[model samples]
Target: RSASNERAGRRSRPAERAGRAPAPRLAAATPPPAFARLGQAAATFSAGAAPTSRATRRSAREDGRRDASTAGSPLTRTVVRVLEVVPTRLRIALAALVGLGLLLGAATVVQTVRRRRLERQRRRLIADVGVLQSALLPEIPEHIGGARVTAAYRPAEGLAAGGDFYDAFELPGGRTAVLVGDISGHGRDVVPLTALARYNLRAYLEAGLTPRATLHVAANVLAPHIGDRQVTIAAAIFDPGMGRLTYACAGHGPPLLLGTDATPVTACSSPPIGAGAPTGRRQTTIALAPGATACFHTDGLDEVPVASGRLGREGVAEELRAVGPEGDSAELLARIVRRSEHQPDDMAACIITALPGGADRWCLRLEELEVDAETLNSGWAERFLLACGVGRPHLGTALLEAREIVARDGTAVIEVRVGEALAEVRVAAPPAVMLPIERRPAGSSAAAEAG
Candidate 1:
């Protein structure tokens, strides 16, 4: 009877139980969007999968624990959360920047490699060019035609090459030819001309032409093509047979005679070739005694700096004298460099030392000049005759004859040979090639005056 009544009371309290509040919930609020989606994916994974054996399930659970541990790391979790929230476009742009940086690094490496290769090639080419340029100024032999020869070539500071050039070679008839000259400018425009002038002068000298004649023809040949550039050349022909060195200047420094006290002949100084002046009109010949040395050089020696002023010819002579005949051209240049502060131009020199007892020393010197007959006057002739060391009586006689000869011919060549005892002056007709096209001014003799 009690069991039946309990059942009837439980049924009657159903409505009250139903009206009471449900048990308190474990979680009240919804998860965030990222977690919510993750939970959904987990539910789907659980429902779609087939049942697995115990061993597989155990391995899966172990992997899941490991994955959870890794995901729980603070830095990793933060990075993952940031990535999940980041916009797709921003991620793509970041990827593009990384790829571009990689490409740029590769390009930079390639460019650097190319630049190094080019630098190596440039250095090699420069070295090769230096060798070729050296060929332009050759090494002279120790002796030519029984005369000791020495030479030196020094470009200006910080230069590989310049206009200065020189050569000494054996000529026909047991003679030797020496040439030294300087161009006005540098670079491609002048290199070929320098070579051309040097070789051409040598050929002319070898072809049995006098030093004055060789320069005369070269002046006319090179003048028309030189444009504004000019060349100053000093040439010499040594006849070991005659023991004489006949030298001439084309607006160049006079040759320095070593171990001699006599003054250098400076009469009838010729102007430079290409200067439109009467070039190669004057030449001087001197006797080179046994054991004598003669130096042929460019104007660089005269242009050095000193305490008083520019180191002129006298200064250069002093230096050469100090060096003495025993020294060579290279040694001479070295001494000059040590003494002077600088060299502004290219320096080149050719020195010839005569063998002792080579030939009889005449103590004879000669000077010759080609003058315009129409322009020849008494005053100019007097100065020239006096400069030639002609005495009063001979001067009067030579002047009278020069006037008569000039009246007869268009031009006269005055040949003066000075000896230890006497001076011989002879006036005669000049060669057709030497006749001047125009009359010289009255004071043209000023440049010809001797110091």
Candidate 2:
């Protein structure tokens, strides 16, 4: 009986403690504002996260309505009451509108990022192209082989760069070689070929090959690679010590000899390389008078647009004469740009001028041809020998020797070195090569072409 009574007392005491624990604290407590509850109820109907249960959401709205009625302003209470009666479709439409606005903002940000990335890529491409152009058309020094040398290049209006290129470098001996060439077309396709041609010709010239040999080798090498295109090329070997300029062309403009002489002989020509015809077959040798300037260029300079028509070879000569011995390639190009209304093609030019004060001007000159032994035996060969300073018994003996060598070897090389009053002719054995190497010999090197 005592145990039963203790259990009853323990249960009654807990009930008594619960009833007295919190009933006295109501007056001292700080209650939450009713308007704050109203705001929470508003958020539930907005684009915010949905309530976990519909029953819970309804109960909260009911509690907020009562709280608003008890303590909120008339406006707050009216809004809460309207939220409770709002249709489900209207709420969903409002949420959808908000989501659409967010999507549009995201799209705008993505587009801005993409545009910036593309702009950076464009700038990089431009920089790379600039570097490539510099490699293909490099800058050269002011002098080569003791003569003032300058070069210029200009692309057409629509091209960043083009097919034309030029180079000038000192050779193995005290000679200087200048090269200029034009590929038939333009754009990216031509740049690789331009580099190939420029460097290939330069390599041969640097290796002590004559201008004619250089072109011959270059023509064969490039023919296989250059599809449906031709390379018009010119190369010159200038010996300042010897005061002589020897040059050859392959379907390209001849080097202009200005100031002292009118121009280079251009009547003879080998077709452009890669044209299914032989090149480097012939070369012209000229004596350079002091104060003389040699201009080597691609055809574009002569083809520049002018008031009357294209700038012809005459115009080029006139410009060089105006620029005179003192002017470099840069100055000459500047004048051309000013005179030209537009450039129709890529132009490249190299200018080489001999020193003003030098030794006595050379009077001996030979622009030759390959004549038959009969022609050499003719009276013409005798006069030629006499003019070369060969006399009497030796002249007869030299003529007989030339005939015998021409008949025996099918051809031999004749080297002529004539000074003020002295002329010397040498008949030398030809070098071993695939083609007849004309070092100013066989005027059949086309018959080594006799002059």
Candidate 3:
């Protein structure tokens, strides 16, 4: 009975060792209850939180699969694997950088659209103002009365229009009236005042009033309408029949008289028109010789910039002298404007030159001649051409051209001038006429004949 009891105890001991080994295997196979709850909470937090990027969600799913596969492994091993896979700080920094880039791209697109819209509106405004300026200031005629008239105008650089104006027109009894003026301020606002002063002064002069009286009347008429603006004007009446020029100044620069022993007509001036009642203005009369030039200009001519300072009145005079006595008025003004270093204001200039011979001498006596006579009598025309120093061949050509013109046009005035180097012929039909004339230089004619 003792031997049988010993065998039973040994069998029980082996069974106990086997059960202990299986117990450890069971524990490794399944996670603890606390670890399972922690894993479930982590899944809930991932699902309930704000939506993450596709890459982040994919990585989270992969981490979950790996943790499930390693469930039979140690808990410390699972924790170390999660820490290696997740990089919260680096991912947050990358996301912030991407968001900033998107914000900047949207801002650039908005700014570009706004800038283009503003540019289009500004260009359209400039075009409209240019058209208005042209209508306000018309072109001056080439001839007024018996004198040759020429003018040039240049607005300030980068401006469409400015406050300088000039006008000339024929008056009664073969007299010419002229005006050159400057308004106080620039741009579109001053244009109306400029028109008012110019047209009103013209009306007064055409009424046969003297220059001083004309200025006085113009000031009174414009005073009420000019508002706070002022106008500087130089007005003149030239009578070729009387060989005289009468002028008045109203706070304006003096008109320059060239090609004679004459001085600037700048005395007896008053304040600019529209500044107070017109008073104490006087007209100065000067003898204008044949071939003399009368030049009138706005302040822009003298206000040009130079190395020393403003070109000034003396600089303008020097430029005029450099143009020489023979330079045409239009050409001279062009040269002066081209030489200016900077143009800060509007420039306007006009010139009237008395013909070398009297107005009648330049016109053929066509009114007294018989146009329909059988032979077209040219004896008188020949004598007039000879008096003008025309040679025999040029004289014959002038007579034949004149006779042909009269026969075709009924009545025509012909102008003939003979010089050492050139001969010119001008034919016109009249009331007010600008003749197209041709000049033949002696050298060129001789060369043609030889060829």
Candidate 4:
């Protein structure tokens, strides 16, 4: 009975406790402002998380409450309480708007920077084009190789420079050489080739190479870089005293021979360089009379469009004929270039005209020197020719035949040919010194004397 009475007493005490409100819970007693602060913090966290649904917001709310409790500072608690006074839904909306604004602003900044960079790059490219143009065009001289010279340079449309280039300089032995060349393709790629070809040709010519020999050396040197690129080159060396022009061609356009009679004749050249090695190739020798003019130009002349597509060599020749001889060479070149309407391709031409003064008639002084046969075969010959701007062809051939002639005989006669005059070279030689050269021109003769 006592145990039953104790159980009833326990039940009755719990019922009494439930009947009275458990004095308000501590969380419920928390001020509204404090609740608002916690709500705002929860929204901030939730905005960052972007969970699947509003239900997940509870996780953020719990995290916020823990952070507030752990803070332990009275000032932080007061501030948090103030923030909590804001409505939870409104707090969440504000945080989302702030986050979106920050993201949009960041994207705009990145895009603006990219645009500015691109504009800078564009400016740099334009400046680079100007620099390239200046370097490609060089100044030319009015006189070359004891002759008056005239030239025309036509730049391609929309380009500051074209692929065509020409040079004329006097070589040793009173020989003068002229070279005209065109590099394939256009733009900066051609610029380097122009420089290479121009300098190489000049060096070879000045090195004493025959026109044909010069072409050979230059073509071989440029072969590695040519790849698919081909070069059209025409070179000529004038020996006014000999009244001959030694010329070679590597697929370049033909030159026009402007005679004193005002008659225009066509001078042909060989195949273009870089096609292959030329072993048995022979140079063309034409009689260049006093008061005669020769013109060399790029194919851009015939490249202009006609109804039959691009005009061929025949068409270009015809055009020059039609322009007539009375016109100045410079004026004629300008007319053709203008006629071409400034072709899309490069156009350049060089003119070398022999003034009325013919050799001795020109009253030029001459000097003669007698040297030994061994000197002709020795390195001295090469050095001498190089100084006079002559002898490259002789040097290359001399090396090959030097030993053969040395075995044939121990002594032979050597001669020096100067200004159309040949002088038998008297050499003091060891008995049996062999001389390789046999044929020599006895004296100067006007092969084709045109009245």
Candidate 5:
């Protein structure tokens, strides 16, 4: 019986040892939550135990699937949000492009309009210049009384209007006065003054005023309007009935006289019309011989510098003589102009040749006036006498005849003795052209005095 009890004690000892920890509960017998928690813990432990092993890989795959589902699900939602922003950004970029295009179009249109406006203004100004230039008549009366007049008008380049003008109109006494003037300054600014000068001169000339009186009136009339600008004028009145010229100058050059010998001479001129402090004086009378020639010109001719390097009257006289007797009035003028071919100044000249009347006889005479008899040497006198067509042998005889008259009057005059009669022969200045001389009627003292 004791042996049987020992076997039983052995078996009971095994059970006691097994029941010491109360035999941990089986995963299947634990509560559902606990069992699930316990299963997750076992899987996590398996993954950690061998991270690269097949069992851990299976556990990792299961966890990865859950993670993928949780994280990848938001990718679609993020893509949708990005797509929503694309349209707004594109709209902004397209709007900016449209705005830039509008600005460029506006700029182009503004430039086009401005350019067109400027072109229109330019055209208008050009038209205005044309009108102003055309207002000056191209045709000048070639014949006025016994005098033939021709003029030339050349405008300066780039100038809107010139300051030069000339007029010829009959006075109230049936005599005609010629007026030529140059107002200072240019452009349309001078147009008003030019018109005023024209009308005023016409009115004054028609009022039968002398050249000097007309100039005085004109100066006063223009003084209020002239401002700082002044005028240069050469005005004259010719009385055909009396063969006399009344003249006045306003700081202008003297007219040239063409003597019968074809030699150029100068007129004795008074002070310019507006130049003198005492208002200047006028030349009441200038005796124009029957065949004498008068030439009026602007300073442009005289002002040109010659090869000799002289200016004004000196140069002009030299040039005129250089042209020689081969050239006529027009030819000489052309030659004078050619000397200053490239000059910048404008030139104008008026030449008058007086022709004698029909059925009349005239003689041309030349005399040198000097006080000293030594100055009047025979050679010098002979040369002038020869030029005047007086015989050399008769020169002393002519001088003797002239001395007799001088002895009686304390003056000297030489009478050139020519074999031919004075009635048929004609003489002229410059020898380029000849004019007839009419005999004065008897008892016409005024006319004779004027001649």
Candidate 6:
């Protein structure tokens, strides 16, 4: 009886344990409410139910979820929820577009900044070029050595300055020398060569060398220095006492001599300076009478392109004649420059006109006189006297007289008449003071008698 009872107890215990284990398993396998609804909809679709409106479907899902919560297993209810805010392709395209826009904007900014920097550098370079040009070419004297001298220089279009240059300076014994030249090219590259040639010519002439000899010396000095560059020069020495002009040319145009007859003084012609071995340069002397004008110019004037053809030497001569002999040197040259139609090269010219009357008739009108004596030393009076071919002694005497007159008369309009043998400084207005000036001949140191 005891053994049978123990067996019954054991069997009952095993059955109870099996029942408890199933209860725990069912609880763990139960699905959530949302996933339970999803399973019901999937099962309904599989059963071939007709599709319904979104609102009807949503209401049906809610009602089904209530039933499923009570009936479905826990494991069948739980699921992951995924929401797509933007389409994958759309998002990728938008990102790419935004990145491309940023890249282009950066590139544009860099390009604009680079352009502005280049512009600034270009302007600074142009300014520097202007300064250098001014230094290389200074204003020349209007009158020198008993001649009315005037010059006109025109650089090539679109250039600040060019290689064409001219200079006129006084020599010993009442003589004047003029130089006109053109280097190979225009602008700053040729400035050094221009300066060297101009100054060397002046120095050689000042040393009492003849025109031909001066040119030879200049060629010798410049040939080795100028590299692959050519130069054309026309040099003239005028002696007012003798009324003679001695000129030499090196691959340059002939000087135009205008008087009763228009003639071109084409005496000497040699290879251009620095071209090759120096040729024996020869000079020609021509009588330069009063009321006559001599025009020296570079090839720019003759090489101007016209409708017919280039304005040759004959055309240049004709233009000069049309300017008329009575015109002032300054006015004449200005008119010629204006008439040029197509000037492709740098133009430089010098016009020398002998005064019709003697030096005595040369009049310099001073509107006002300064109080300082030093002003008398370098004023219109002195410049006019020097232009009138006054020697150093005569110039000193003239300045002394001018100083005395200015001291006596405070501020007055004075007329200075520089004659060959005398200089008269007289006040034109009230408080008049007349200072007579007597000048001795050249090479004589006779004290000037002043009254």
Best by TM-score: 1
Residues 1-451, candidate 5, lDDT per residue (tens digit)? 9999999999999889987866686675557897899999999999788548788777886686555555655886575455445676787797799999999999999999999998898677756665675476334565566555555444443436766676765554445567777777678887788778767876766666656556666787777787777777777776656665556676676566654333311222233334533222333345454555556666666655557553567666665566433333455456666676344444555555444541113222222221113323434434445555555456566555444544454434332323235311121111111123455766796777888
Could you tell me how far off, in angstroms, the CA of residue 403 lies in candidate 6 after the best superposition?
Answer: 61
Q: What local lDDT score does residue 54 receive in model 3, on the 0 to 100 scale?
A: 96
Candidate 3 off by > 4 Å: 1-128, 157-161, 265-268, 324-337, 359-451
Across 85-164, the per-residue lDDT of candidate 2 in tens digits comes to 77879878977998999999999999999999988986776566555765788778876775778898766665356788
Q: Evaluate model 3: give its TM-score.
A: 0.54
**lDDT scores for all predictions?**
0.79, 0.74, 0.68, 0.62, 0.56, 0.67
Candidate 4 lDDT score at position 278: 42
lDDT by residue (tens digit), candidate 3, 1-451: 8999999989988999877765443445788999999999999998889688999988998788677657766776675576556597976786789899999999988998888886787566655655565466657777678677776766666545577888888987777788888887777777777777778877777777766667767777777887888888888887788676767777777667676664432322367887764432434556666677778889888888777788877777777777654565567667766777778887887777775554322221111111222324736555555555567887677667767777777654545433234546555542222222457999999999999
Put the candidates in lDDT order, highest first: 1, 2, 3, 6, 4, 5
Arrange candidates by TM-score, descending: 1, 2, 3, 6, 4, 5
Best by lDDT: 1
User: Residue 52's C-alpha lDDT in candidate 3?
Assistant: 81
TM-score of each: 0.67, 0.57, 0.54, 0.48, 0.46, 0.52
lDDT of 1 by residue, 100-212 (tens): 99999999999999999998986776565455555798788887885888999776653345778899998866677889999887666777888989988887786667888
- lDDT preference between candidates 5 and 6, better one: 6
lDDT score, residue 390, model 6?
54
Candidate 1 clashing pairs? none
- Give the TM-score comparing model 2 with the true structure, all chains together: 0.57
